[model samples]
Target chain A: MTAQPRIVEVRQKVLRRNDVLAGELRDRFREAGVYVVSLVSSPGSGKTAFLEKILTMMGRQARIAALVGDLATDNDAVRLARAGVPVRQIVTGTVCHLDAVMVQSALEGWKLAELDYLFIENVGNLVCPSSYDLGENLRVVLMSVTEGEDKPLKYPTIFNGADIAVVTKIDIAAAVEFDWNAARANIQAVRPEMEIFRVSARSGEGLTEWLASVESRRAAKNRPG
Target chain B: MHELSIALSILEGAAEEVERQGGGRVYAIHLKLGSLSGVAKDALIFSYKLASEGTPFEESRLVIDEVPVVVFCPECRAERRLSSIQQFCCAVCGTPTPDVVRGRELEIAGLEMDV
Candidate 1:
């Protein structure tokens, strides 16, 4: 009896192509001098609220644009546009995450050269968004004070990919008895050196510092080497 | 919840692969899904059946190799597979936070088909 011949040595990455496209898009964003930032958080974590306030504060100085994704509805974009910033809505029919392809599609008619800051608010899904890259310079993961502090531990992948963490709705922290210390501890446990901002979009607290940080980062990127 | 979409993508990719490698019916698909991938194996299995309906992979079975989360213990200077993402620390030495060495993968290894 002849032994059956077996062939091996097929090394393939299913998502390697997507990662390549994401790298290309990152290069495009950098070359255009656009500070691309993406936001990821759970449902109703006040992403829109925080973004609206930030956009309003960043008017004139920065030509800011936003792309908000949801499972349905253009409500977030509509709400965000009232702040006098160019905001677009991406309705991902049945998708759970915003991948690189979606970001590429979202920038179809967008003039990247005209914008200083471009914020892409991913679909409100902690689990799905972490697996996909949207070609952003920074991925900001937001966690509201009302949510359990253990969210960082529950969704460590999201936290780990994030460049910074924004603790939203801090004004109501005491009302909800939110463990700010535990929240900080959880985030620090997962990402030791991640920059964190405790901001209240409603009360306008910590807005200056957050705005300053954004400006500093953008300025540092534009520095002559 | 997004398992159906992932399953559909898997079937679509596998079908294309099989068609490119001559005409053959897919028998099975091997997947490596880590514990920290945020994808439930059972959910993907349940969705695979629905997604494969009327597709080239209609009769294929999904065999998943679940990988545990592995972390590097700075204290012990060793890598260990973690039981859970919540407790991603050293098994011994009571280390608080360690770097995640592995286990956040969700990939389709390959497809098996009758040539």
Candidate 2:
């Protein structure tokens, strides 16, 4: 008789290692009382511009640091450092998304407890970044007015994965004929009750409310039980 | 693409599982892939070939089961599977649902091996 092959049951999540590392990173962030926020979006969605605004505004109230990831170049890092905060660039080389290990390695010489807010700017991509969690307390997904309003519906995975959504380039919304109500409705349809913020980094229209909200959330997270 | 990284992870996991089984040659790896997992099946398959080269999984075949998006409907009080990812509402009651019951899976379910 011919030999029979065996079938073995091995139920294991493929990303288990990353998940475990992310859990450790989360615990570390919690212990240090550092509020980590990450930004994700498609290219040219003004993530860097918005982050620059946030760093400038919130830096006055807290000690902030930024780590930006890109396939190549430290352009974003240099630009963000102009805000006069500690900034580092994690050049991912060929990696499309940033994983927990990358974030952990990028934070090698830094002390988490010395900072209030740590911002991670993920490589600009809506699809791949949704699958990787970088151990951030707040994950912000952004879309610019220049992109389609149905962007949320098109990439619902990212929208669902994010804690908040930010609509960037609002100052040029009128000029671009961006449909404001449609965008809001699309976001609502995808995530039901997701918190959304509209801001113009150029004109600083909605910076106050956004900054105040971040401060309050950071404060609340650090509050004793 | 990120599929290469995913394929590499799969190879590592599969190798460990095979080794844990007290030595075997893997013939096929069965995977459960959900559309919401953000992985392109064709790309992953292509990348798997590159990732498995010169490894124990070099000759293994990837058998994928595509899982459709399923969500819990509060209005219907039941879980419904959607025909398409674009339809986020309950297939039965048609109410919008953010409570996903199933999908978003990326796991190796089983392996066919020669002992």
Candidate 3:
């Protein structure tokens, strides 16, 4: 037998499989004209409440749906479904974060082609979610003002992974002694070019601008190059 | 934690590679972990053992290379290795770097085997 070095210079990424699946999902989302917005944040950072408001607000303009992920409990799904949109709960069964496989499975049996907007609420953790690609067109990482300004510094990876950083609960920023400027600076320190959105899901402050940003991005992608 | 999910993916990737190679059991998986990979090595070590249970990768060793985060100082036009992952400031110039030339990766770069 000829000696052929079985060692192949693959140069393939470790998450190559997930990347492939995510690409396919992206194509599916593009073809269906569905704009997917994924939310990720640490526990109790108001990710659920934020999505609830989003679903409630966007309920008038278009058809919307959501998939919520958690290690346990279907509470968020219940809350979001109150907006009169179809919501699916993905109980991760002990996994700390949702991966591409979980996202792909959640898409099954659903007519993605029919939906206008799809939102995925990730498990309440910053670290793990950063590593997984959940096939989303937009990944919005939320940080409530109640959290520390050093949040982006400590959890740099999660902040860096996000396309946009949403500072939530601005209504209580001062009451909670939250330093808004420092938080923005901290995020910029970690990811210099990341978009910033100061939103109060409860007060509806900054929601219109946030929604407009999402719409413009969707419109931009739909535009021919 | 998320380490379990990452460990699962690592095992799956290694298994697929091993199967395609005809015959060999994975003895160990080598991962080049950059300082900015966001993975705490100690935590991954603990999670890897737990994730490998009842799977083809059971009993396989995990070898990790601690790669230092290196960046190019745009101001000074010099490449420097970060003293720590948390410390992104250039050592010599003390300038904030614009691009991440190396570091911040979660990759299964290589694998050891028994054919």
Q: For candidate 1, what is the TM-score?
A: 0.89
lDDT of 1 at A195: 84
lDDT of 3 by residue, B52-108 (tens): 999878888888877776778888887888664444667787776646778866777
In candidate 2, list every pair of residues with a backbone clash: none
DockQ of predictions, in order shown: 0.30, 0.71, 0.32
Interface RMSD of each: 3.7, 1.5, 3.8
Give the per-residue lDDT of model 1 (tens digit) for B1-115.
Answer: 6777677767766766666777666678888887767677899999999988887677778988888877888888898766556665677775855477777777778766665
Looking at model 1 chain B, which ten-residue stretch has the lowest summed lDDT?
A: B81-90
Model 1 error, position B6 (Å): 1.4
lDDT of 1 by residue, A81-155 (tens): 999988888999988888888889888988899999999999998888876767888889999988988999988
Model 3: runs farther than 4 Å from truth?
Answer: A1-12, B25-27, B53-59, B70-98
- Candidate 3: true interface contacts recovered: 0.21
Model 2 is docked with a DockQ of 0.71
Better of 1 and 2 by TM-score: 2
Which candidate model has the greater lDDT, 2 or 3?
A: 2
Name the candidate, 1 or 2, with the larger lDDT value.
2
- lDDT minimum window of 10 residues, candidate 1 chain A: A2-11
Docking class of 3: acceptable
Which 10-residue span in candidate 3 chain A carries the lowest summed lDDT?
A2-11
TM-score of chain A of each: 0.95, 0.96, 0.94
Per-residue lDDT over A67-167 for candidate 3, one digit per residue giving the tens place of the 0 to 100 score: 99998988888999999999999999888888788889988899988888899999999887877787899999999998889899898778866889999
Write the residue-wise lDDT of candidate 2 on A1-225 in tens digits.
Answer: 756777889889999899889999999999998999999999899999999988988777789999999999999999999999999999999888999999999999999999988999999999899888788999999999999899998998888778889999999999889999999988877776677899999999787887777778888888889
